[model samples]
Target: MRIDLHTHSTRSDGTDAPGDLVRKAKLEGLDAIALTDHDATEGWDEAQAAADEVGLRLIRGIEISTQFEGLSVHLLGYEFDPTHEPLVQELGRVLGGRNDRLPRLLDKLAGLGMPLTEQDVLAGARDAAAWGRPHVADAMIAKGYIKDRDEAFRDWLVPGKPAYVGRYSADLFEAVRLVCQAGGKPVIAHAWARDSGTKITPELLAELTEAGLAGLEIDHPDHDARDRAALAAIADDLGLAKTGSSDHHGTGKGPAFHLGANLTDPAELERLLA
Candidate 1:
């Protein structure tokens, strides 16, 4: 099966609606796709319904915001029950931290004289705190705050950049345990990039593997072939499953990546299903 295991929808930072994403996957000849929305499983119902319509298999998933050693560690949860309460509670905690920290970020920016506000981000957000910088970037772009997301992050959004806020209270090990309790396999998202810095060391990988990490996202838009090779080797040495995908988020993301373009095959889907 043509499976794109990693992707987003408006339920998180992605521009497409849940059902629309399924339709787009169908158009791209994808046999299976996972609705790995960031920090929430709210899109699964709509995604499943849409997948039914398009005859595409929708793997229920979530991209959780977690941490290890004060660095952001995005955990991908796959093949879990949507109604799983433990997962629900933990996601709520993670997102609640997200909500709380974002405002603190706004407050920090204001103190720094940037004058950015949560209201600015919320106006563009589809709902609650499920979205982040992208919405702010779009609003900034719309209001001419910055040229695009790249400029937005470089100028105002990325960590250590002006107007950035730190998100604390993210316990990555607990997130892995929660996904395991929810019957989902948790995978560490894109590492080996300059952005991750010291976060992707062998020791860190070992710690996460011991903490119940099931896989590593070796294929991604940011990872070069050499990086992927290093990650794949690490996954093998550590006995973690190796996975790949284009983290598609519609037109908002740059070119050369979209649904099914860079994908994990059916065999991997079968492995995930198992």
Candidate 2:
């Protein structure tokens, strides 16, 4: 009954390939896992195939980047129709933004005397459907500029860092609306992390719930105990389903993340998929 509803693969920022992710999930004894890769559904087919072979339940999902009150927010969409026109178009735009931002990021890095080329980033991206900051970080690692993803973010990629560059994201309300329009459930990912909680107040959650946000990610590695409790209370108050997930980005993210580390309640999973 353990369900980890948010994960990624090489199709996005995660180090593992889609098939390997499913096999690992099965080995980890996860009853179910969702391949919620950033902005793309490209990993679904491979992950699903591996899930079938491994006898693991797979939930097709995307971790969409979004903007709310000028801060970055991630929207987890589950069981959505991938071919939905609006969703497809929006994802393309998001992916394009990711692609477009790279050169600028590289330029900034170059200005800071840490030169990297688009080819370098693409080399790290491999077959990823979307190229993003994590891939850039991977490029930095490959070039021996930084030891790992964390260092890359800390020293260069994160906001306020020398190599940081802003990119396009869908509006939060529009993202929620589009997920519901595409017949999917939308849950705010890590709603309370990194001062996001200050922006995503109960009042805002209530507003988002009205806009078709179905769930709150109440349990996450980044959330403090007080934050989790507060979010759970908000979910209850707003009648929103509550989900928990590892937000696993594979080994590069850190040692703390693992399959089923933070799990969604079966009852909540049912509610989410309802």
Candidate 3:
């Protein structure tokens, strides 16, 4: 069965609503899709309902914002109890950081002569539980400031860029512990992408494995063949499940990140769900 284990919806950075994302996955012939919206699980119920309607398997998951050695990390937690108190509280802090950084980011952009109001960003965010850089990029797109989210991040939003702003994130090790405590499988999402490979070494992966990291997202839009090979070797050595996914964000992300662009092997899916 085809399974794309990472995605987002309008409850976070994605442009599609929860139901629409699931329905589109069905159309794309995906047997299963995980709704891993950044730092929030608000989309779960709606997405699950749609998945049931379409006879699609829905993996309820969350992409947690985390930090390791001062660099950003994304942790994907699958099949967790959403009401797990510690995890819920930590997510609240992470979402708060996203919201807290907005004005500063906008102010920096304004200084660069691309003025925007909170309303502008919020309009783009729509049903998102918290505003994020993608929403800011959307505002920039609407104002003709940038062609797409990629350009916005490449030119302005990414770290070391003009509009970049720091925000609080959970400690990566603690996050893994919390996911495991919540009775979930914790996977590193695109662990070696977006310059994160510099920090996510084999040594680090081994360390995180000890901390209950159950898998690695081995195939992603940002990972080249070399990156995949290197990560695969590490996963093999550590006995971690290897996952593949589209990281779909609907129109919010680029075309290459469409639904089912990459898929988890059925055996791997069984291992992950085991």
Highest TM-score, which number? 3
Give Cα distance to truth, residue 106, candidate 1, Å. Answer: 3.5
Please give, for residues 155-204, the per-residue lDDT of candidate 1 as tens digits.
77777777777654458888888888778898888876555655478888
Evaluate residue 44 in candidate 1 and report its C-alpha lDDT on the 0 to 100 scale. Answer: 84
What's the true lDDT of residue 123 in model 3? 89
Model 1: lDDT equals 0.78
Which order, best to worst by TM-score?
A: 3, 2, 1
- Which candidate gets the maximum lDDT versus the true structure? 3
Model 2, span 77-192: residue lDDT tens:
99999999998999999999998998898899889877888898888787898789999888888888889888887778877777889999999999999999999999999988
Record all residue pairs in model 1 with backbone atoms less than 3 Å apart, i.e. clashing. none
**Candidate 2 global TM-score:** 0.97
Which regions of candidate 3 are displaced past 4 Å? Answer: 194-199
Prediction-by-prediction clash tally: 0, 0, 0
Per-model TM-score on C-alpha atoms: 0.91, 0.97, 0.98
Q: Give the worst 10-residue stretch by lDDT in candidate 3.
A: 192-201
